[model samples]
Target chain A: MRLLIVEDEADLRVALTMSLEEDGYVIDSAEDGEEGLYKAMNWDYDVIILDIMMPKMDGWDVLAELRKEKNTPVLILTARGAIDDRVKGLDLGSDDFLVKPFDMAELSARLRALIRRAAGKTSTVLTYRGLQLDTAKKTVSVDAIAVQLTALEYALVQFLLMHQDTVVSRTDLYEHLFNEDDDSLSNVLDVHVCNARRKLGGTYIKTRRGLGYTIGD
Target chain B: MNKYRSIRWQLMAWQRFLLAAVLITLLSLHYHLRRKSEIAEVDASLQSALMSVMPAVAPMMGRGGPPPYEPNSNAPPPRYEPDEENNPLIIAETYLEEIESNGYYVTSWDTEKGLMLSVGAVPASASLGNYELIVETPHFLTLNGNRELVVTHNTDLIIVIGRPLTDVNLALKKTRYQLLLVGSLVFLIGHIGGGIIIRRTLQPIREISQTAEEIARGDHSRRIELAAAPEELASLAQTLNNSFNHLDSALEAQIRFSADASHELRTPIAVIMAQTQAALKRDRSTEEYKTILQACLRAGIRMRTMADSLLELTRISGNGSVLNMALTNLSEVISSAVEEATQLSENHPLSFQTLENSRPVQIDPERIHQVLMNLISNAVKHNPDGCTIRISQKETAEWAILEIADEGTGIPVDALPHIFERFYRVDESRSRESGGSGLGLSIVKSIIETHGGTIEAASIPGQGTTFTIQLPLNPASDR
Candidate 1:
């Protein structure tokens, strides 16, 4: 899973980025609404956390501009807890609303839900063959037994299963599993896939010679 | 049923009272004049009857006939004799008979012959007595049950004529009833008409109150409609509407201030909370722990600065007595503030051009110093390193003027007016890095206002900005 944080406060933005990144999700952040909008317009993140008050452009204008082209789930994070602001944020096509000083755990849970829903999955547990992924618990199981996989390997498997019948390319994996700051080598995807195959068994994953990789038939 | 306290009801009450008083006065005057004229008619008839009957009664007075005819005299006496052909008794009875059938009581009394003649049935109450003949004058007398009689006396004979006052009394009675009926009708009509007029006149006031009530109930947009209001009420409604506009704007400003304050405080709090929670989630090396602690510390310091600024702003704005005013020279305060700024920002050039005879103005010296420092620091902070911050003082007859002008990249003209508002910033992103809590200008404006002064900012986008302050020479300070 990947997220974008558009906050004006430097410390809060940094803290949010570090904390969410530590939760095994890729995080990209912008300092103001202009850059946030620019990045949001170009990228395909699972969820965007927007702040209302910003310089150059406000979150409202950013959201309005973004909604013209995309249906990315948006969680409005603002210091204004007034009902009018909340109603306005929701009315402007925001998926969720959270006031400032919100709990990290709650934010993480909300982001997970947004990501899951964006992929058209109802339940947290995604299963194919004998492998099961619980999105809420951030855990994977094989035949009701726990499987130990690194955060990157877990994200790769989850993304592949989410796209299920289709083949996901290497570029798609890089965009979904890593943020802009990551300098992933061209062969890094193969290394992660090889390690995951060794842990979860070889038949659970398959790779097309030129296309990319897929988790199920 | 009583609306005595309302202007409409009171106006009607007063108007109806005056109308009733005038009606009563007019009716009574009419009744008085009518009664006088009716009684005059009865008295005139009585007097004429007496005069016509006097000749016939003279022969019966036993004075013989008349004095012998005298020539060459002022007057001559004609002969009057008692003969059967022109019989005195018959003539006297004929005159008496005419009066008797006409509802007049007639009585003639002769003292010398002890002769008393009466015609018609007079009431016992109206019987003539000898004492009534002592004077030769006509007098009005009330006979049986208020019937009026005219009594006339001659040198030797007394004649009494009485008439029933039914015609006079009936006419006056009719006049009285008419007065009452007309007065009552007029009063009823006036009451209803006056009530309607008053209500119509006061209708605008009622509408004004209703609109004001709606505004009081949180419909601040509502206003009294004045298109059809009367001139006096139109002016009143206009004044009330102006006040409502002012109050509405004031409340809106307060709400914006609170929202901005919360936003400013919440950001730092969120930073502290997120950093602490992240650090507590896992064990980190000493260097990582130090980084997280430093981040929390910075956020804490920012919050403290904001809290102090907010408290200072509130103290100055919430009350006038918080100012400690004294007589101080504006130039002296400016000189010290400029000196401090020179040390604080050595790279930025600061200059103070003071007037030679800077007059003493009544002000809060400490607050004024704070204002100077805040403005000077703003100039130093917003401008480039080598920009010149010029501080100067001038005086008018009534005010001492202080101008703090900066020669640097100025503020945009659109944001100048709102710069003094609490938590307002020219550039939010730059303001954060500049370490401004955003309450500095608001506090300065409040302090100046408490000292009966005005502050204004004029900015030329590329040239620079100048903050001009006008302090009263001898302030009627609020404190």
Candidate 2:
């Protein structure tokens, strides 16, 4: 999963980024609504966690402006747990709403749910041939035997598994596998993929020439 | 924003209604009574004149007297005589003198004497009691140019006496016009007087409302001055002043809460996030993992406590959480809270003085217990190891007071007033070490207030901090 966090509170923004990155989601953040809006216009993200109160502009205006061009899934966060703010955010095309002081687990679950729904994948369990990935349990089984994978390895394999029959480009793999917290301008995709393939078996993923990787029979 | 008519306007309307009803009724009564009395005086004089000539003519009529004073237009009219008392024509002559002297035109008639006529100011064509009415009274005569009063009574002869009504009608008309002018003047004066009175009466209320609006808009220092008003208005002003005082304090508290919420909650989030991110860049050894987890655990604990405190605040301020009042023993509540505190304490010893007596107080047991627990927890958290905390109680004439003294690093004098404010920490560094969210005192204050009690704190920079809480022994309902 890939996500963007647009929050005025720098501490909360950083904290949410680190926690979600630990859960294996590539996260990018903007300090204010203006920067957030600009980024949303240029980049594609699976889910956007938007903060309502921000400088330069507000989340409502950003949502309205973004909705004028795109239909990305948006999650709104507000300091005030007031229901009125929730109703307004939902009305303005927000997919989910969370108040401040949220737990890490809840944040991770909501992000996964938003990303899954956006990809039109209803079931939490994804299967390709004899390989099975349970997103809810975050476990993998190949031919009825358990397979152990690191958080990053699991996320990379799950992305390929979700795009079972399509070619996922290397650029797409890097965007989904890493977040801003990682040192930039480095190619770590090859190492993570070698590890994922080693654990899930080489036959489970097929690499397309000049494209990326996918999981198929 | 409210559309109701002003009290000033209502008062003015009522005054006008009362003045109009009373003034009009009294003026009409005076006019009718005065008119009747003046007409009666005129009739009495005319009847007396006929009586005066009766004794002289009473015997002459029985001795076969001829018809007297034939006003034959042929005998040029005779002049009146003042001393002609023995003459039967004296009555006619007397009226004739009045006519010539005072412009009192008169006409007399009798059964034996045919109609003896004079100048016809009224034409005398109709009998007595016939007069055209003008302005609700027959005191005016514009038609036939006859303004006179005709008075008739039978004595030895049928004497019909008439005095010209012009003067009476003019006098009564003058009175009517004077009355109208005076009544209007009174109404005008009353209108202005009532307006002034209403404005003066409602002036204080306007000032109170203006002050209230200012306070509502966040000018909490604004106040109503009651000393300048009269006793009645002063009471109303005093009530408003009291209400404004409470509202102003509540506004101040709300502002403090919001400020603390944003500023205090960010620090913990920053610490945890930075530590976690720095630790996650690469694989780490077990010792490094233990350090990172320990730091994260401290920050996480602070956030959890802060969230719990925030929830308690919301519950106290919100309408959904109402106090469930029940009779509770103070000793039991104190003991239960202390027992819980002992389990959570990090080696600090707590001492509770055994009460000489126990009283059942009307209170929400759970809320009171929460208050005790918060105070005890704060005591346990702030104090160093081996530092002692003493909890004791006393009874005043109207209150039961609880005293909790901590031998910890006391708060500064400047921060004492804000100790009970949400997320207010005297020493940020020290509180972070102890995982304090600075919301403990605020929760304690809220719970104490919900039980209709007051909590006060006194502390020196280094000696210690003592919290004195006074709960009413008799509930407000009992009082």
Best by lDDT: 1
Q: RMSD of each candidate? A: 8.1, 15.1
- Tell me the tens digit of each residue's lDDT in model 1 across B123-191: 223323423223266776656634334343332333555456766777788888888999999999998
Top candidate (TM-score):
1
Give the alpha carbon lDDT tens digit for every residue of A104-168 in model 2: 66767888788788778998899988899999888999998999999888988889887778888
**Local distance difference test, per candidate?**
0.79, 0.70
Give one digit per residue, the lDDT tens place, for model 2 in B230-252: 78878988887888777777777
Q: Can you tell me which runs of candidate 2 are displaced by over 4 Å?
A: A1-217, B1-4, B53-164, B200-242, B268-304, B317-321, B345-353, B387-418, B452-469
DockQ by candidate, in order: 0.72, 0.04
Which ten residues in a row are the worst by lDDT in model 2 chain A? A178-187
- DockQ-based class of model 2: incorrect
Global CA lDDT of candidate 2, please?
0.70
Flag clash pairs in model 2: B147-B165, B147-B166, B148-B164, B148-B165
Model 1 stretches astray by more than 4 angstroms: A34-44, A56-74, A80-97, A180-191, B55-137, B147-159, B276-325, B383-386, B397-399, B412-418, B449-453, B458-464, B472-479
Model 1 lDDT at residue B362: 81
